[model samples]
Each structure stands twice: as C-alpha cells, then as structure tokens.
Target: MQESISVCHNQYILKPQSIESEELENATFHAKQRAIEARQTISPWKKSHSLYETGGWKSLFENINQPLNLSTQSKEFQTRYNESANSLEQVVESAKLPLCPSGQPEIGNTVVFGVVGGTVEAPSIAYLTESQPVTEEILALSDSVKPTEIFRIASSCQADACRHFDGANCRLAVRIVQQLPTVVETLPACQIRSSCRWWQQEGKAACYRCPQMVTDNGYSSKILQEVGDPYSK
Candidate 1:
C-alpha cells in the first residue's frame, strides 16, 4: 500500500521534504500561505456554494437583490437549505471532485457526502442524503483523530492545481474506478453524486465502489490503501 501524504493538522502538505535550507523552507511556507489566501479570495466554491446552501438558483439571483444574510439567518433556513441541496440529487449538477490526498483546499466550501464508520481494520462508508457543509467548529469535534478518517468530503475540482489531476483528467478518480472493486450491489445515496467527478466520469460504477473509499485511510483495507495512491497511474 502507498504511504499517505504527510500533513500538519488542517494544512496543505505540498512536497514538504524538498526544502533543504531554512531560508528555502521559510520561503516555501510563506508561498503556501499566500497561495491559500489567494485561493480563498478567488475560489468560486466560496461564492457559489454560499448561494447554493442558502437555497438554489433562485436564491443566487435573488440574494443579490436582498441582503445576503436573509437566507441563512431566518426561520426555516436549515429546512429550506437542506431541501434545496438534496433536490439536486435528482438533477445533474456541475462537476465537483474528491478531497485531495494532501488536504482539503477550503473546509468552508467542502461538503460531507459520506461518513466513514466501522473500525480501523474494517472501515466502511455510508453515503449521506443531504449535503452537509463542513465548518471549523464541526471539525473540532473530532479532537485528535483526523476528520478525513471519519468523513468522505467533496469540494470544487482544482484541475491542474491538484496533484491527482493530469492536464486533461483526474487520475485519482480514474484509478479509483479502475482499481477499486465494487463493494455494494445497489447505488448508494449520495449528497454530491450529481456533481461528483467520480460519478460523472465513471458513472454508476463509481458509486458501486464508493462505499470503500477512505480519504485518509492509514488504517483501511490494503486494497483501499493501494487505490488511494495519488500517483499510481
């Protein structure tokens, strides 16, 4: 099984070992911080998902006219948001991809589609019906354990910016569909299936095998650990 990429609590693990000098290490750290800040400023996931979680297309265009907080701060907000998000399960949504091996780009925009449960020796994933946006507060509930070990998160596809993505396609998604075996006979309920890159590229086969996908599966089955390799292809 391939070793999981090393990470420092909720931080992006971008080729950390290559820096041989203190000056170079400082430069790399600063560059990463800048890149993260820039991404947060410009990433469409933040702007788009904010509108999406509030309602849908209606809220998107309508919220521009009304105050932004109206959708999120009012009564029936949670109910309406969940209903709106789940309704997309029927209609095909825009493409979103899996959380990267390094780490999630922005947890504020990341959605929890599946829950990793069972034990370390025998981990299993259960898909969720409603989209659940992750918050910093929610992640704190896990304490010492990595949240990726307990959740299958989906976020906006980073394309060339992600290591698993080749110039044209997502190699990790491809590897998953090709190397991972189907664990479920029936199509599992998914919060992001309509927008999932795996589902869009691999179709029902991805969903069939999705129950076994663990993002930070250091303790997962040997087969899963192998499939999790970002550079396998």
Candidate 2:
C-alpha cells in the first residue's frame, strides 16, 4: 500500500528564537509610549470610521465652524476660510486608500509561512517563495492549524475588520517597530511595500523590522499583549 505525503515546495522554515524577559518588558513599555504619541498626532476625524468615511474634510469644517460664527462678507475671514478649506480638501482626498492587514489573503501573493510549529514561547514559521501559489490544498492545510500560525500576504482593500486599525493608523505597525529588532538596515525587497500600511504610516522604520513579523493567531509577543490585539475583544 502506498501512502500520500504533502510536500511544501519553495518553503523555508523560520526557526524560533527567544528574547529575555527584561527585553520584552522594555519593548512593551515603549510600544505603549509610541501608541500614545501616535494618538496625539492623529486627526480627530481619522480616529472615527464613520467620520473618515462620511467625509473627513466635511467633519473638520463642521468642527472649525462650531467654535465661531463667520460672515461671508468679511473678506479677511473668507480668504482664510478658503485656504483652510483647500488644505482640508487635500487631506481628505489623500486618505482614501483602504487598510490592508498583514494576514489577509490577497490574490497573487504567496503564502509566506505555515503555522505547523509554533508556541507562545517562540512562534515557528515556514516561508514560501514569491513564486509559490497559495493553492486550495495549502489553504486547507492552513485551516487545520491555528489561525495565527498561517501567515500570508496578498493585495486587498483595507477594511474596518482589521485589529491594527484605530480608525486612523495601523497601531500594529507602530508596535512592531517598537518591539522588534531591525534585522536589516535597508528595506527588504517586498512586493507589497508600496501599498503596505506599515510603510505608509511608519515609513522606513516599519520596513526595517517587517521581515521579523509573523501574524500569530495567539498573543505571541509582549508588545502585542500590551497594545491589545484588535482581533481580540
């Protein structure tokens, strides 16, 4: 009798590593500080999904006007209002891109890792080359594993369902930067870099540590626990 065995081609195992408890504590503290700083910079409208979608510029205008009474006949006021309106319009237009989560299966991208071996102590990973397709067989295999163990990346519109979203920015990106060590000085060659939310929000710093990220279904890192996983309640 012959037996069937699954072969994962173009796959590389990501060995697990340990971090000192003190190091984890520091990362967690820093991640909270980063989130606080980030919240301060975020526009009020950007933090609310309803406002962001309804029209961030419109909301800004309403807020600005709520505090004062303006007359159209006043030339100086009209001029200042027009300038502010133009600036607000520019901001609202630029915020149209949808959010994309790291784990979402976007078409064409490869399954970067499988969750076959991972634990709370050290999350294991299995990487697939860019050329490899995430076949139905692969996805089926993924279903049998812990949801967090299977890591995949693909292009897709960002939506409200993502945990990292604060209705404004991807907090996960910020936490990842605060927690992980930069494995590379330069941005790793990534197909999704252009549209990546992390790159868009945090820039080069996010890219520096991106290679070390794994979307664990369980709370795998201290920083994640501190920040509160969006996927969790």
Model 2 per-residue lDDT tens digits across residues 1-233:
11112225422233232233224323333323433333344433232322112212232233342222123213333343456544665435434653343443322233332222233333332222232334443344343332223443443333333445667776666766776655444444454556667788888987665544444333233443443344422
> In candidate 1, where is summed lDDT lowest over 10 consecutive residues?
11-20
lDDT tens digits by residue: candidate 1, 22-71: 23223323333333333344422222221112112233234333232323
Separately for all candidates shown, the number of backbone clashes (residues 3 or more apart, or on different chains) is: 0, 3
Candidate 2 ranges with C-alpha deviation above 4 Å: 1-101, 106-134, 155-157, 228-233
In candidate 1, stretches whose alpha carbon ends up further than 4 angstroms from where it belongs are 1-108
Clashes in model 1: which pairs? Answer: none
Taken over the whole model, the C-alpha lDDT of each candidate is 0.46, 0.40
Pairs clashing within candidate 2: 99-158, 106-154, 148-217
